[model samples]
Target: MAQPTTSILCTDLGFDWPDGTTVLDGFHLAVGPGRTGLIGLNGAGKSTLLRLLAGELTPASGTVRVGGELGYLPQDLTLDTTQRVDEALGIRAAREALHAIESGDTDERHYAAVGDDWDVEERARATLDRLGLARLDLDRTTGELSGGEAVLLHLAALLLRRPDVLLLDEPTNNLDRHARSLLYEAVASWHGVMVIVSHDRELLQHVDQIADLRAGSVTWYGGNFADYERTVAAQQETAERLVRVAEADVQRQKRDLIEARTKLERSASYGKKRSESRNDPKIISGKLKRQAQETAGRVRGMHTERLTEAKERLTAAEEAVRDDAEIRIDLPRTAVPAGRTVLNLDHVRLPYGTRAHLELRGPERVALVGRNGSGKSTLLRAVAGEIGPLEGEISTPVPLRHLPQRLDLLDDGLTVVGNVKSYAPAADDNAIRARLARFQFRGGRADQLAGTLSGGERFRATLAALLLADPPPQLLMLDEPTNNLDLASVRQLTQALAAYRGALIVASHDLPFLRGLGITRWLELDGELRTIDPM
Candidate 1:
C-alpha cells in the first residue's frame, strides 16, 4: 500500500500550564497510516498530545497540523442511555430506509448532495446489515446493549461519517476476547489512517507502528510493542550512562569547591596575622585577598554549570523509565489452606424472587462460569455470606476475602488510602503506605481520591486491603479480578497466585487466566463440583 500523507503533524510544539509549569517544550511528532499505539504512564501527557492532534487542545506555541478528516473515539464514552441500539446511530434514517426498501423505491436523485448511490435505502440497509444492526430492534434501548455491542454501534455511526483518519483511545478496554478480536479485525480492514492509543500489548502487537510518549517527546518504534521494548531498553541504558557521568561530574565539582573554600579561609587567617605582626606588609595582604577572590569565582562558576547539567540528567532519569513496564504489585495469596468445606449450600435456592439452587465446597480455583444472568455472581454472594440462602443451610469461613465483580464494595467518595483504611483502621499508616507502594501507587497518589482512581488502581487497593489482613484468610473468593487490569498487572497477578498457597474460588470469564492459575477443580452452575486435571 502507498504511504499516505501524514494524518497529523506537530512541529516545535510548546505548551505550559497557567502556573508556569511546562508540560511540553520543543515537542515534535508526526502520525501516519497504519496502527500506531501511543503509550505512556498515567500522567506523562499522552492524552494531552492526542488532544492536540485531534484539535481539542490548542498548543501554547508552535503548530499542530492535520491533513485529513478525523473520526476519534475517546477512552471513555458516555453513551446515550435513552436511545435504542439501532436508533442510537440513526433512528429515523434507518426506519425510512426500511420503509423505502419495502416500497421498492430506488431513487437517489431526491438527495443527490449526500451520495450519488442509485438506491439510498438499499445502501443504508446494506450498511446496517453488514454491521449486524439489521436484526436489532429499532426501539431496543442503547443502555440495554452489551458494552461490546454498543461500541460496534458507535463504529457503524462513524462509518456513515466516512472519515479518512481514525483515532482511538484505550479501545478493547471493556471488551471480551471475542469482541476484542472483532475490533482488531475491523481496524485491520479499515482503509484509513488508524492511530490507536492503547496500553493493550496484544492490540499493540497487531499494530504497524508505535509512538511511545516520554519526557514531552514522541518516539516512533516500527512494528509493534515487542520492537518498542527492544528500542526502549537500548535508550534506557544510554540515558542511565549519561546520568551517572553527570552525577560524577557534579560530585567532583562540589568537592573542589569545598577544598577551595577551606584554603580561602586559611589564607584570610594568615593575612590577618601578618597585618598584626611588626613586619606585616599591607601589599601582601591585598594580593592574598585577590587570590582568594579569583579561586572563589572559579568555584562558583563551576557549581552553576554543574547544577544545570545535573538538573538535565535528573529529567532524563525521570523520562527514561516513566513507563518502566515492570508493573510493581502483588496480590497476596496464602498457602495455609482453609479447613475443608469453605462454602456449602444444602438444597438451597438463589435469587429470592428468581430461580436456581446451588451446592458448593472447599476447593481451590473453583470457577463459577456461565452465561450472563446465570446467577454466578449471586452464588458468590451466597458463599460470601452477603446474602442468606432462601431454603438451605449455607456455611462459609468468617475470615474470607471477596473481590466483588461490580466493585460494589468500593465507596467512590473516599481516596484509595482512605478506602483501605476504612477496613483496616487499626493498621499503621506507614504499613498502609507500604502496601500501596507494592501495588505501584507511589508519590502523592495515595492522596488521590478513590472516586478519581482508574479502575485498575481501585481494584488493586481493594485487593491489597483484603490480602494484607493479619492472620491471612484461608478462603479467597475473587469476582473477576482481571476485569480492568492492564496486561502487565494481569501477568504479575498470575505469577503471584501461582506462589500463593491459599484456596482460590474465582468467578471469571478469562479462560486462560483460570487455566494458568492451576485451577484444581471445576464447579459448573448446573452440576456438582468435580476435580479437574492440574497443569
Candidate 2:
C-alpha cells in the first residue's frame, strides 16, 4: 500500500513553558492525509503539539509545515455568549457585505468583503445542517445553544472554512450521546488531514490510524483504536518477557561472579599453603605469588564486567515496561444492604424544570444519561443536597457523597492526604495514608498539593477523599466522572468502581464505561425522568 501524502509535518520541534519546563524537545512528526488519532497520557503534550500545528503557539525551534489551509478546535472553547450565531460561524462580515450590495451600496470595501464567496450563508447553513444543527438560527445568540450545540457550531465553522488540515483537541468532551454520534459521523466523513487528540474510545474507533505519543515522540500504528490496542498489548507482552529474561541473566551473572571470586580466594589460599609447605626459594615463591595474584585479578575483573553488563541490560529491559498504576481499594464499609432504601425522590422538580420521582434501593448501579442541557447535572446536584428542588423532597436514608463534573470539591491548597483527612476527620494519618496508597497516591504522592497534580492524579485523589469519608457514604454519585481522563485513568476508575459495593448513580455520556460498571438501571432526564434501555 502506498503512503498517503504528508500534509502536516513537524521537524526538530522544541517548546518550553515560561517557567523553563520543557514540553517538547527535538520532537518530530509527519501526519499524512487521513484521520490520525493522537493519544498520550495527560500532560504528554498532545494538546501542545496540536496547538503548535495550528500556529496557536510559537515553537522555540524547528518548523511546522502544512500543505494547505488549517483549522483547529481547542479543548477549552470559550465562545462569547452574547455573540450571534453568524458571528460565531465567522461569516457575519460576508453576510453583511452581501446585504449591503443588495441594498445598492457598491462600495469597493463591501465588494472586497463579499469576495467571490457569494453563497457563504448557504454553505454555513448546509454545514450546520450536516452537523445536526439544522434548526439553529444564525440570528440567535450563542447563549441560547446548549453546550453540545456550541461545540457542534464551532465544528461547523471549521467545516465551512474547508481547511485542508484539521486539528481537534478532545472534541467529544462534554458532548452527549447524540452529539457524539454527529461528531463521529463528521470525523468518519473527513477527507482532509485530520489529527485528533482524544481519549474517547468510540471517537477513536473512527480514525484511520493511531499515533501513540510518549516521551515527546510519536509511534505510528496502522488502523484504528482497536488495532492499536491489540498491537500495543502484544508489544507489552514481549517487553515483559524480555524483562524477565534480563532479570534471570542478571541473577546468573551475579552467581557466576560470586563463584569466580570464591574459587580465586580458594586458589590463593591453596597456593599460600603449598608455598609454606614446599619451602621453595624466596625469589621463586615471590614470583609465583605475584603471578597468582595477577591471574586472580583478571578472573574477578572478567566476572565483574559480565555482571555489570547483565545489570545494564536488565535496567534497559525494565525501562521498556510501562508503569501505569491502577486504583485498588476495598470499601466494605460502603456496602448497602439488599433491602435498604438508598434514596427517594418524591415528585422532585429541578430548577431546570426536569421532574423526577424515583426510589433507589439496594446496591443498584444506575446510569443517568441524556442530551446536554437536559438537567443531568442539576438532577445529580439536587440529589446530593447541593441544591433544593423547586417544590419536592429528596430523601437519602443513608449517607451519600457526590463527585461533581468539575471536581472542585478538593481544596487546591491542601495535600491529597490532607484532603482525605478533611473528609474523614476521625481517621488517623497513617490509616488515611494507607488507604490513599491503594488509590495510587503512596507516600510523597499523597503529600503533593492538589494544585500540583495532573488531571488523572487529581481525579484519583478526589475519589479517595470521597470513598474514605467519615460515616462511609452508602450511596455514591458521580457526574461525568470520565470527562478529561486519559484511557489508563479511565481503566483505573473502572477498577476502583468495581470494588465499590455501595449504591452507585453516575451521570455520564460514556456508554462503554457505564456498561462496564454493571449498571442495573438506565435513566434519561429530558424535562422528565424516564427509564431507558442501556444504550
Candidate 1 has what TM-score? 0.70
lDDT, model 1:
0.67
lDDT of 2 by residue, 1-535 (tens): 9855649889999999998989999989888889999998888999989999988999999999988889999999888999999999999999999999999999999999989989998998889988889998888889878777888999999998889999999999989998899999999999989999998999999999999898888889999999999998998899999999999999999999899988988998999889989998899899989999999999988999999999999899888888778787899999999989999999988887899999999999999998898999999888888899988899999999999999898999999999999999999999999999899888799899999898888999999999999989999999999899989899999999999999999999988899999999999988999998767
Candidate 2 minimal-lDDT segment of 10 residues? 2-11
Model 2 TM-score is 0.95
- All models: lDDT? 0.67, 0.92
All candidates: TM-score: 0.70, 0.95
Question: Which segments of model 1 are wrong by more than 4 Å?
Answer: 1-6, 9-29, 43-69, 74-144, 160-162, 214-217, 241-319, 323-335, 338-382, 387-395, 405-417, 437-463, 469-535
lDDT of 1 by residue, 321-351 (tens): 4354343544444554344656556666777
